[model samples]
Target: MYIPQLSNQKAFDSFILIDGVLHFFQFTIGSKHAINRGLVGVGEKYGFPKDMAKWHFTFVMPPNRVLKVPQAHQGPLKDSKLYSAILDVGVEIPVE
Candidate 1:
């Protein structure tokens, strides 16, 4: 399942559920604050478990761009045990 950005306060760029895990994705040019706040808000709104083991957060940006996580949000993000990933734009697919 996949959902696009919501019009609420806890709006996220994308939401996906694979198997039983909830994955929230944010695509940003350089706003670290938005990424930090959005993820936290979504978890709170959904009443996710404290460990957040089933939750995944992905930060997507253009190729060659680097996103830096804010220091203040580092601990919470890490402690939640959230899975994180990155996807670059304009990658070619191989024919198999």
Candidate 2:
């Protein structure tokens, strides 16, 4: 998805699922309104929604693999820059 794939982006970051579950992800920014919003979810922790029209979500899918996103990670994808971030479960934060 890209900015042009929508009627308009006036209020918040708008995005569409290009690949529900695939090896790659993508998104296109539409209106600035949406881009400014970033990611959104039930809580404020999931990365603020971005206006990227397409966002690529990828994980190594294995046979009989039931991916369970950590409670914190369920919110938003980590910055791609942290492609190899180590997960430290010893530190826990109480959620509201």
Cα TM-score per model: 0.54, 0.21
* Candidate 2 wrongly placed segments (more than 4 Å): 1-50, 70-96
Give each model's whole-structure lDDT: 0.56, 0.29
Q: What C-alpha lDDT does candidate 2 achieve relative to the native structure? A: 0.29
Clashes of 2: 20
Judging by lDDT against the true structure, name the best candidate. Answer: 1
The digit string of per-residue lDDT tens for model 1 on 25-64 reads 7665663534454566666776655455566667666555
In model 1, how large is the Cα lDDT of residue 24? 73
Residue 87 miss distance in model 1 (angstroms): 4.6
Report the lDDT of model 2 for residue 16: 39
The digit string of per-residue lDDT tens for model 2 on 19-79 reads: 4311122222211111122433421464323532233333322232233332223234433
**lDDT at position 44, candidate 2:** 46
